[model samples]
Target: MKRKIAPFILIALSLIIAVGLSACSESGRNVEEIRIGVTGPLTGATANSGVASKQGMELAVDEWNEKGGIEVEGNKLPIKMYFEDNQGKPDQGVSTAEKLFNNEEVDFLIGDAFASSVTMAIMDLAGQYEKPILSGEPVSSAISDKITENPDKYKYFWKGNVGSDAYGDSVYQTVKMLEESGDFQPTDKTVSFVVEDTDYGRSNADEVARLLENDGWKVVAYETVEVGHTEFYPQLTKLGSLKPDLLVSVFTADSSGVALVKQINETKLKTLHTAVYYPTRPEFIENAKDSSEGLVWIPLMFEPLLRESQVDFATAIKEKWNVVATPNHALGYDTMNNALTSIAEAQSLDSEKIVEQLAKLDRDGILGRFVFDDSNHTIKAGPEYIPVPAVQIQDGKNAIIWPENISTSKYQK
Candidate 1:
């Protein structure tokens, strides 16, 4: 569904345009390059995510530059990147955004941290400063809810990803389908959750739990841990004791995900295991290998083994960066491409035109089609827009198992 922009959102758009005009860089100036400031955890626990995002952004930049750059006012302006390391800290994210605005004077910004805490920290900079921001990851529903609740406050912000609820829906439907197909049977209708202690983690955990509870499943245990906390033994031990039929883990760190898999095996927590976010990274399989066998996860977008388009994008990324591409890389690539497409379509740096063009965009990327729900300035999720399929790691490869029409393999446990 498309968003019906309220009057306040229009007013907010006007404010963004007015601010953009006063900012000079987004106005009639001798602009040689489109300065884009990028934020990612380039040097912390999630450095792999940061690096992948950087590579994706670079790929997008190369594509636009190869096309002779974005034409505006008879001048082709190339994109120049100003990437900063947030280290996955909220404070660092805020400070990094400030630096980008004050020092680089970037015409646009992209957030790649994929964490709600970090995205929320830097969201206001779009309005407070004179630029518009688009984010690729960070799936917490709270971000969209906030924009919906206070449109005027977030008028200059846009999210290129679907909300956390999509993850919940994917996991819930996966479990339900597995049961319906007689591939999964439970002694008791019980579910457990272990997630990072952040909005993204807690939000996904609560959403999936809510769906299962509504379906008559009892909640056995709900555990939260700090980001990068690898000590799942305590939580795994508790889960083993309870023996919930399903255990869902949500985290963003590669180490945390790999550690969870290894420890779950060590603890022999036999409950059917599912996950969100982390397992999509290639390092998870490289690091976890056999331990991740039969693990079901959601939201597979850029698995090279899944689609020819995926393989094409992964091949380009490998040729460019010498590293295997992950779903996060696809997200970052699509996010940047969406921004550039809108900017070029607008033909001017006017925030009003760019934002309008963005809301009307209907394009395809490595993930799937890109269409925003104008109601809340977030991407639509599902089969028709973006398919959020459930996947299982079998023999160190991605085997899509749920959403049967797109399933390449059946669920094996």
Candidate 2:
């Protein structure tokens, strides 16, 4: 049995070994780290939200790596995170998504954490090549609609947050309960919208409008602006002239919100102003502190100092990054950990198995419990799951004024 192998046979065996190693992954992950391509509005428009999300994601990855990463089969792997900014642009999101996939060779993607327009830009890339994709904060129901429309086609896509439709429920119920309880009085049952032009803004505005209309409230005006557009004087002027009893606005860019609130101060409209999304951002509070007073908004689920645990967590983040953590940060942290937990459940890097575990995931996060409905590939929303409570900005603080059981304070005129 000591016969020597031919040179040609030895060369053939070497080639087979190389091919097997190369075929181990779409991206070369046989050694070193598991790469996650992180994308967000890191530099423009909703940059604050983007930065907050990135920090939370980094913290999660750092903690995971500290634990020696999730064991896959028998070996432990560490995670390496790298970010690309989408600038809140849809085209930019699509391009960076490709760069993450074909160039950086990322095994997973957490992306466009700023707005639905940006998230949807790259959402389908996962299904295109069968890679797992997770998104944070972009809650437009259209994303869920797309997934449900072709569940098999987009089996790899998962949304970390509940749909924008939940916001409709939150806004309508908050208003109705307050009215019925005599906590709020309305001279005129009219409302209007000033939302960003993107799908996230339009979708939420539409939902809020439909619900308000069902309650016999007239929708007087609906205005849309570009993502970073700050000139809200015309809209404010119109709202002042019309004198709608309520004005509901949505924006992702903190600048837009700051501008709108400041202008609202100048216009001095008497509407019970209710905002969406932006007020949760630190920049909005800092830039428009006086104007944000009495501004009602939804889903105050992750105020940095809302709880003692949040205070400790925020302190840690501040010491590390010198930035204030917000609800957006918590959302990012939860999204990352939830995805990792599913990967651990799968016990392998196989995309199909990971998606399988994702569909079955039921876990608690800083925000609340996360349970995805495979029918829509989104987290469920309700008081039992995730509460979308409305809050009024009262003297540099958020006061929960709706849903009597959890109301921290009664509505202030």
Candidate 3:
């Protein structure tokens, strides 16, 4: 009878061991299951930019996860991202944020490539949920500062790119450098700024105006009109009277750029200087045909070989994507990388700690040495413009005309 009781006790102990082993297996799985959330205009007017950004994010994540993800303490984890299409609408973006915060339970967040207005709608939500949001492409200065205004409500958001005001400041530097180099007369001071009637346009126009005034330059004219104004001749007529030495037009897409250049060429403004954003693209030059000649634009970044590292990166990215990578792609890559690195450093799934680590980063990644300012979560990498050479359309090609080292093909004058 004693032997029978001893056998029953051994069977019970075996069952308990089995249950404990199963629990351990479920609780200690690999860290690759970390989830990140991403939102963007994947199916709307800004779809091209969205697609490029998505690709950059996926590329970085794929590479990182392949390397066993980032190391936290003694364990390596894997990262998985869940992306939602915002359709480039504020309402859609808000819905996506809701899903990410409530249902998906993502460890981190990214994007809203347009501006602060789009980011603002979802920033508070991220903060309320205590989830870190590493911005992908919004350039407005307010994206970061808004958080500082309401620290309790927006403590989890951080910027991983430059602000919109930086571009205007860079343009100012370009103008000053050109004048000092004797490329233009110091009296070539009359400047005209024409912007489309949009939030981005308004902010850009104001910044440019303020910058020019601060620099003691004569602002010949400052104007804003609806984006789809096909006929720019009326405005061109007014600008012509101002006798501006420089014409700075910020238009979007191929159609608007072509229309602007056609109006400029037909009006015969004889301004001797013209600069525009969309017109700098290859498609814009092709659409403008001969009218694109002699247009000087300042690009935030370009794909041409300005330096060894840049040339290599541009060639590699272009070969992979079959098109030039815009600054949007750079922002996307940096944002995702920063978010993932923050996750590794935090060593926990808590968003509050991740945000803190991101704000303290001093690492140099694809977008160069960058660190988000603690005061406002703004990334400061110094004002480094790509120095968009004075490229002119000549003999069926856009050729550079400034800085002897980068002048590959001279303009056919």
Model 2, runs deviating above 4 Å: 1-29
For candidate 1, lDDT tens digit of each residue in 204-247?
99899989999999998999998899988888888888989999
What is the per-residue lDDT of model 3 for residues 69-133, given as tens digits with 9 covering 90 to 100?
Answer: 87666567778888888976677888898887667767788856544456767777766677788
Clashes of each: 2, 0, 2
Q: Where is the poorest 10-residue window by lDDT in model 3?
A: 381-390
Question: Lowest summed-lDDT stretch of 10 residues in model 1?
Answer: 22-31
TM-score, cand. 2 vs. native: 0.91
TM-score of 3: 0.77
Which has the higher lDDT value, candidate number 1 or candidate number 2? 1
What is the overall TM-score of model 1 with all chains considered together? 0.91
lDDT of 3 at 42: 80
lDDT, model 2: 0.84
Name the better of 2 and 3 by TM-score: 2
Candidate 2 lDDT tens digits, 1-413: 33456776888899998888678643555556677788888887778788888898888889899899987777788888878998888899999988998778877787766678878888889888688988888899999999989988788888889999998788888888878878668887988899999989999999999898888899889999988788888888877888888888888887888999998888777777888888878777778979988888987887755545577667767877887778877888888898788888998778899999999999877777899987999999977777788888888888888767877887887
Candidate that would win on lDDT: 1
* lDDT (CA) per prediction: 0.86, 0.84, 0.68
